[model samples]
Target: MTGARRDSCDVAVIGAGMAGMATALFAAERGLSCIQVGNPGGILFASGLLDLFGVHPVAERRLWRSPYAAIAALAREQSDHPLARIDASSIRTAFEIFVAALGAAGLRYAPLGDRNRSVLTSIGTIKTTFGVPLSMVAGVDALEARPPCLLVDFRGLREFNARQIAESLGHRWPDLRHRRIEFPGTEAAPELYAAHLARALESRQTRERTIALVKPLLGDALAVGFPAVLGLARASEVHAAFEAGLEMPVFEIPTMPTSVPGLRLLGALETAVSARGVRRRHQASVRALAFDREAGTAALDVEGVPGVERVVARAVVLATGRFTGRGLTADRGQVRESILGIPVLQPASREAWHQRDFLDPSGHAVNRAGLAIDDAWRPLDADGKPVWPRLFAVGSILAHQDWMRSKCGSGLAISTAWAAMEQVARQLRGTGAG
Candidate 1:
């Protein structure tokens, strides 16, 4: 690896989770040159439902229809929570920009509004989330009206059971019906994968055949629901075709990851960032990150290449997620920040991390552990000072908020990315630098 290339940019975004992607998108949108590192495989696990503060008071699991109201409540009760710290206007702008970028990349979402929308899940559960992809939007209306709905599933797809959903909701929506048919070409296959079925549906033959199978079973149903196996590349087109062929409202029920919508999101984000001229190092990660205090710059040692390559930039945004993304590591004694070894704010000891009962209403204290950031979004040292002039932390890597319980994962990522990038832009210009 003698010829390892070194690159420079205005910003080097560490990690490629939702937050990192949002940060890169924002930075690039601002006309700042950005080099984004790390693979964003985690997006593949997303349900494609962008949740923006659906629940508050984790112990009670209180769901909110108005995300703005939930944010206000969170601001009052948990002032330090990341979502609580940002202004509502900034949050709205962030979501608008994020979803707009995705839409440009062919992953259209329902228009953002003041309240959260309820979307159906493959397990027959209703998830309250903010951004619903256009392919799944009709289900939102169908669910609310409780119309004569028909749910469809492929014969070999084991993950989605249309019958299970129909049975579970039997008492409430007796008009709901479910049927299964062999996917056009996967009839002989004993088991089917959603991604494969999705890719296959992109073909006109497959889409038409699948529609033909479901059209006969439409009965008097006003709308039809299917496990989300629409086309991978052209999902909206495929979904629209289904509605036109069946002459009914067609919606998709999100299944567990790795999901078709997740794939679309990942592809759309990549397309959006690439279109904005953001340089990406997919499947690579930041091995080491350091700042040159005198130069007013940060440097990264990127791994997963033939050899370590260097990336120098004016600023860096850490969007590495929590334990799941390996941004925060834990041991028997304590938790540690993985990439930069920044001090993590955590419980007194591992023993105090969890409650005696694993199912305690209150989430474990450990779940809320991560880097502490200044008001400006810079990661703070143990003495509560900025670790680096231009270093910023966003997403689940920030401390004092349990995104999972609060259902603000997407909001926290997108909104904070917008706010932090604003700070980055302002600080860079103030210093007469890019």
Candidate 2:
């Protein structure tokens, strides 16, 4: 066996989803050396709208204008929910630092406030979310005002039909109209993707050509809405050019999953953490994790890249995401924690996992199945104690919360990460390891 020394750090964060990224970011910002692992699947599906809380008391589908109020209700109603455990001030500070980092990485957001804003989606539906990218903020105002607006789409872009969107909501918003035009340079392609169009628009010539085509069509349009294809790396510049050329407010409605906004979020988060000096392992998965009880460190075996690599850290943060990210696995009998096989707090049996009616308004019991943590955010074993003193868990993996239904996906991920990182900092530094 090679006697080479292995890489060491203050923290090893598993799962490359938003929660994992936040954990690593928070750790690094607090002066802890961190290494993060996992693929980028989670962030790629994001809509780039950070939802703190929109719906609460899932059974009633109650929507809230102020997320702070929603949390207050959640705390009083569902005290066991992970998000309820995080105080309001810490959550605010967490979002502030998280968004500031993203802005620095070229993804600016409108200043966050207590109230949530409604954004138009491609399906003619409105999504209530807190954090809005500067490029998409105008869409919020346009939707609220329902003024004369032109919804634009390219000819070959599937899954997004401007006319359908306008028709669906036209009765309620009569001033809304839609127009379809051929993209400047994609006449022969027969099909187009948001990411591809976004990259093309980064070129001044292509952006100008596209703007010229839309300029003549903007007859009485006070606002212009396009698919979220402003640009990839230079989205801000491309968005500005469209707004300037059209002499009106230009906004983008986020497309379905695997979109340009999602790509931008993934890239920006990666850049943000990397810039803060956090090490990363992209397209990699952890093979095994073991704790050195005497040394107070964790050892991880990761599989994916060239050779099987090992990582050791003084503390470990399990940000491994839920089902989609494969941080939790389910069988015919139970949903088990993916990496460590820790006891997952799930339904009594598979039979009870879901309601008899698939569309039950309250949602399924299994949706809340995940690791149960203590006050310090450490995942508990069967005996109801932390698996390890230096170990923690964050994000959707925590039991007793349904991020999707609550519309607090980013908040759950970011807030839990912040709250847990605080405990991690204290434990490590309290032991003189920092």
Alpha carbon lDDT of each predicted model: 0.90, 0.92
lDDT of 1 by residue, 35-74 (tens): 9998884798999999989888899999999999999999
Worst 10 residues of 1 by lDDT: 1-10
- Candidate 1 contains a number of clashing pairs equal to 0
Clashing pairs in 1: none
Best by lDDT: 2
Local error of candidate 2 at residue 96 (angstroms): 0.6
Please write out the lDDT profile of model 2 over residues 1-434, one tens digit for every residue.
Answer: 14422678999999889999999999999999998989885789899999998898998999999999999999999999998898999999999999999999999899998899999999999899999999999999999999999999999999689998999898889999999999997889888898999999999999999999998988888999999999998888899999898899999999988988999999899999999999888867888999999988899987777556788999999998889989899988889998899999998889999999998889999999999999999999999989999899999899998888889899999999999999999999977887
Each candidate's clash count:
0, 0
Off by over 4 Å in 1: 1-3
